[model samples]
Target: MAEEGISPSRQGRPSMTSSMRSSSFLREHQQYRPPSKPENHYGIDTVVEDLQATSIAPPRQISPFNGIPSPENPPVIVESGVSHELSHPNCTPVPGTTSFDRLVATLFYKSTSPRVSNAIPSPIRIPSPPKRAKSPTPHTESEIPPNMSPSSSLDTFPLEPPTTEPEPLDHLYGSYISPMCITSFLHLMSTFPLPPGSTDLNSAHRCLKLDTAHGHHPLVVELTMAPAPSLDYLSLSDLRKHELIYRFEREWNVDVVLRSDTLWRRYPRLVVFDMDSTLITQEVIDLLAATINDPPDLAARVSDITHRAMLGELEFDSAFRERVKLLTGLPGSIFNELRPVLDVTNGVRPLLRALKRLGVKTAVLSGGFLPLTSWLAGELGLDYAHANEVVIDEATGRLTGEVKGRIVGKERKRELLLEIAKKEGVSLDQVVAVGDGANDLLMMEAAGLGVAWNAKPRVQMEAGARLNGDSLLDLLYLFGFGDEEIRTLTR
Candidate 1:
């Protein structure tokens, strides 16, 4: 007897074949028959056709460096007798525009097409990973799976920038500081007000290298905090923040510029400068006064007025007129002598050169005479030059004690800055003003980044940032330029 659903030959050993028949065999050979049409069937031909139709990608070439092909040495692709190179290592011959390369490239590069801001995530409600109580265990090469490639593992688990659901009043602070100072700095910062739900102070901040330059490339320390509810009733109450920045500067001997971690200030489109005392060591007007020592007391008197005007103690227009009147009989040829003698402030040339290389428009707005301003413009390759023009007697070729055009006073300097920014199609927020006098306050206030360059106490207190470094080239650091970049630009 045979078991149900089992043939007599398969009853004994499961490996027994139909050809090895028992004694009860009905015939030596059995007839062959194919399955009915209703049964499911699979064949080698069907598998090959399905694979061709789907256009399945072949295994990607594993790059020796970081498992991703370098742009310089991309994988070569052959199509229609022409060998084309694909920069994306993961790209394949997909049928439509929905290739992996097309989708991933958008993630890395900016698009010129108009953006739909409505689709963007809320700035304050970004998602972040849960905080870890301890440092993560170090990962070793042996921990990687044997069959998994490096790129595949990266694709499976990608590193992402931190996202947090911070309050609307949360503030961000960025500073260039040395590694040794960070611990002490953070210790001091711990006293600052923190946002609600805050845990560890150490976890609320991060440090990163903003540049790869050798020799004293400061790491950028970013601290995020939200003022206590009692202090956050109004948005513009930043007295404490400014106080902290000032204290930090005085203690560290380095400026800690406060700004959003955004791209706007990093790349300014225009930089306007004050000629006297800012771009140059001496006031051109004072230099002009010294040239005429007929009275011997003339230089001292003029210097007194200039100092008063720069300190905001006197009106610029009156002070300028008083100084120019003393130079009534000075010969026009004096400009020729002073042109070569005028000392440009240290780092002015390199700073201007770097700005020019970056395609930033450079200008000189001077309260001095137009002749000297024009000469400096040509020497330093400034894009625009504006100054008060001292009228010269046509017959005698001497100063006539009269200004020919609109005085480039405080108001006019600001107006000129806007006019130039408009002409160049740059936003006011993309402009930087550098000056040292009270007259420069209006223009500096109007610009996005107002730097008081070795200015008086009044100007330093009111300006956006104060720079007291020995060289004006230190100004580059405010724009996030590292030593390597400064060297390259100056070179």
Candidate 2:
């Protein structure tokens, strides 16, 4: 056998046959590399064929900085195991390192390692991601409770059972009802023992969601309960039960009012409002108390009493007297100063304007003195204004600290509401009362719809409905008026 070494060729040049064999040995023992093209997919057979057919090419010195093939040695394109040499293009080369260079280096150059298997490792079997959980249904069909006990929290009036079949609910003043609120309220109602008239808690209830222009949500929903002669206002007492209503109000922070759903309730002939805190932001008595500086902090002391009176902690008559006694020496001219400065509650002007446009008669029944109430009534174009009279001493030119006429306490407020309703020839069921204190509760109860406007806790508990929202304009919503409708009416 011939010596396994470089032998002299015919041209006196050392033969490269031995060096070629060494290169092949090195490549076979080198670490296996993957394909250059990311898109190239190879089975085990393809990988093995590629490894076997790859030819060793002459080493080309690639610039470390540019990673470009030298001009003397151009790129080799392999097609079907056949090498085709091509010159580098004249155009600017790709900026970054490419996979072709890497492939060429791997096939031609040798690294110190044993030959790697040609078989492609089993393709990674990644588990598919888990399915997402389904969301709960928005409205669940609530089951009616067996025993519907009457709530005993409110002093509700005796509602005469309908001797005739219940009337059709045509004129319904529906408001946007929360599904959560309705669901929760129904759940609460389930706790009550089934009253005689109501068939099932869920039987006659209807809920609808409609798109509206006025509210932020733009979606208006109304919950309509079937009329039940036995269950009035969801109360327990045969005499007066406000428990369920109060619990609903306290728990949900939303009012639960049961209406007669009559045309009269829908288009009320008269709407009465408490002047202080309801129409105007400040209590007129509290403002009058500020005029007395001789007692030093008399305004502060009287305001405390006024607060107590509004909260039902003190009797309105006695509290009025006490607060008035503090204002005995205050000048009547102080009313003038208070007139311009009195901050009206938000949305008052718009609400009144809308009510007037709707052909509804409006009134102000204030616990405050007549001067402010009458002035406010005149300013707001109210049809009627009733309030307590303050006796002014003609000689002293100051307040006498005595009421001239009958004190307009809780009973008087209710009386005034009834009187105004009668005077307008409007039925008692066609009157709407809105107020913010304990004194207003009686008036609110007597009216067809009694709205507690951001009232005391006790008042909120007792009133037919309570609204704690920011704007008085929201009252229009209770009348089943959309934003666009209210705008048109007001305009």
Candidate 3:
């Protein structure tokens, strides 16, 4: 049997084969037996009798062949009239058996035996083993099964999902400190009473404490909160008051308090204008170009480039050079002829008169040729004029296409604002700057108030306030002027 069919178990003992007696025993057990008249039957009977005489059971069938009885055993005999030659040819003896196989065979044989059918027990289903908890120690090479390598085990079971935790509150707060948080903290401090005999208000003390903890100067913190009522009682008798007042003045300048019904009361100061595009509808260069043999496209391109430069996209010098290059050989006489056609912007006369009557010294600061700026300034009765002088070729009387004086870029404009303020004996806070270009950013920054009139988006973002939907005369509203004052000034 050991030399016959292989056992299913990977590890087991060799198989055992019973002698011929076992075959005879099996044949005797069966009701039909071979007939004595057949010689083949006689041979089979002799073999079965010989196996039976040896007192051993027949070997269990393995496959279809090799089911012949052994020659030794003779105690068990075959029945008559059964054919031995007709057994299945493919049967073979079971081989390499183990205790497990023996148990399986016992169950199988008992189930098939007719005599043991009544005694056959019901299948006892073994319960599956409970799962064991994983050990804390990590598995190493020795712990894994023989068929499963480390890589194979890793493929079988993936890593556990990562655990995520919320960011700490301090880290989140450090990343983004809301303005509302500051206001809320101030409000919270206002709820507490001031310490006895302390001149400092509770809110001011809280601010000081916060500043001290954060290593910021107490005076700077006080200066920042000076406008609030919470810090009103703090002494401002020293130069600190002047600083605070200056700060307040700058803040008040940007705020359009004219609509507050307190403009004249809060700030009584001067106003200024830019002649081209600011006070007038026409740009002097475009006006000159429109009178030339040049197409309207030239004027449009110059204006568009000028507009973009003012909004801070291209550099002022670059835009100016590009624009001037387009008008390189044009006659200077074009300026003289187009002067009369320069259109005045809407609300100019009224806004000018309103500012004049309000005792606001009005001026015109222009990047246009002085001739055009001066003519417009005189026509409008403006108090002062500042503009570039256009150079002319001496022999041809044609335009040189170059400015003679300072090119009023942002820095020069800022200088002009400061110079005007100093010469007029007023602080920068007393002056109001209005313009619609990138070159005006410095001037706007210098003045106490900056008004962006129908300005580009960039100018609007940087300017203190914008006037898109309203007339220039609406500037009076910032001074707290009403419709009555407007009418009076115009009249």
Candidate 4:
């Protein structure tokens, strides 16, 4: 055994037969130690095979800064995604570390691949978004009150009993209805409640929309009895009853109006409106008050009086006298300076366009000064204008306390409407009147259809129809013009 331990032929080597036996016995007695490396070094090829056999996830590209996946020691991921390896040839293992331990740490602790997060996929189609209306629907049908009682939110007009269906358009009017019937209005044939003699649809006459602010659709008053009348015309009295819509609208802050198809609509030859706060957005008196010395206080006082006067609490004639008296010292040229600043109501231009399209005679009857009214009429292409005349002192060239001629108050306004209607060869029922004051009430009532444009509560209550906003073109809705018709008229 001694000779076998050392080479038998080597003379320099010591014999270690006894030592060899002793070391062997000691190795057999010691506890087991694991290998420093795993039996298989699973690099890219080994990992790819294991991955294919396992879950088969795609290879993840790890950045260099993160541990274990540096430039020299790249991450090992198989295409089939069965397994992975962390150990690299360039990496030196720490004490007690093995391939299995390194693999466990790398697989569990490594950050997600940049390729997965940064990749852009193929484009896919997405549905288009729904379009929205230019103006939101003011209300839904559900919001419209079913009851049309005088006190309810919805006002109703009692329809006369349906009369016998009349003869054809050729038989009634004795001629073909004008081409306007094609482009001027909405449904005038069946829905409109025509008076006794009307056989054909007059598009321009009865074309109107009720206040749409409450809803997208024109205003609809619940009929007292179903099926609106075809025989009777909607008169000033009938128009007044319909004010329940406008009156209750105050509760909702809705701005809209409804014009009835009536005698006035059939023969509408005259369109009359107030000057201040009706045709124009501003009240001439209020604007004039601002022109006075210490205008703030004067404007407040004048506005209060104007408010009271508009409410019918004070006579418009006296109120006009009192209000204008404050303008005694203001230069008459102030009106000219202020004239350019005046803005026509939004509905004014549109309504005027509609009126001109219909060839209706238009007039302005104002309690305000005549220069502004006359200028407005001229600018707006109105045929006539009537207002209180302002007297200028020749020596001082300032406004005098006295107004010339008759003060164009409520009674005068009514007279003017009648006068215009007469000159147009039409009856009082042919006149369409619009205003925003107490003075406008009498004349508004006298006209076939009286419209209150942003008037006082009393005026709104009394007028046939009330528009509760700054837009004047909506008045054409009262004439039954649809959106397309209005657009065409304006164009």
Q: Tell me the spans in candidate 2 whose CA falls farther than 4 Å from its real position.
A: 1-182, 186-220, 227-253
Residues 1-491, model 1: lDDT tens digits: 45655875576766657676566544444575454554455554654555555643674443233435576445775555999765685565556644111000000001112122222243343343357644376334333332333455576553543332222110122223554445545565566554456544532444322334444344444443333222353122253235654554444444454443346757999999999999899988888889886999899999999999999999998889889999999999998889878888988989998988898999999999888899889999999999999999999999999888788899999999999999999998889999999999999999987888889888888887667756788777666665677788888
- Mind giving the per-residue lDDT tens digits that candidate 2 earns over 279-366? 9989998888776677688889989999999999999998998888778877777777789978889988989999888889999998
Give the whole-model CA lDDT for all candidates, comma-separated.
0.69, 0.66, 0.56, 0.62
Ranking according to lDDT, highest score first: 1, 2, 4, 3
**Every model's TM-score:** 0.59, 0.57, 0.47, 0.52
Q: Candidate 2: give its CA RMSD in angstroms.
A: 28.9
lDDT of 3: 0.56
Clashes of 1: 0
Q: 1 or 4, which is superior by lDDT?
A: 1
Expressed as tens digits, the lDDT of each residue in 1-491 for candidate 4 is 89787775687767667555654665757698566678765566655555456642476643324445666556775555577776765578677753220000000000111111212233344443356544354333322132222344333443432322222222222122222222211232234464465454322222233334433322321111112334355543553354433332322223333334344554477888888888887888888887766755988999999989888899878888898888778888887998888988876787788789888889888888888888889999999988888899999989887889899987887777777777778777777888888888888889877888778888877777766544677666555445677788888
| TM-score between candidate 4 and the true structure | 0.52
Candidate achieving the largest lDDT: 1
TM-score of 3: 0.47
Off by over 4 Å in 1: 1-180, 194-241
Model 1 compared with the native: what TM-score? 0.59
How high a TM-score does candidate 2 get? 0.57
| Cα displacement (Å) at residue 125, model 3 | 69
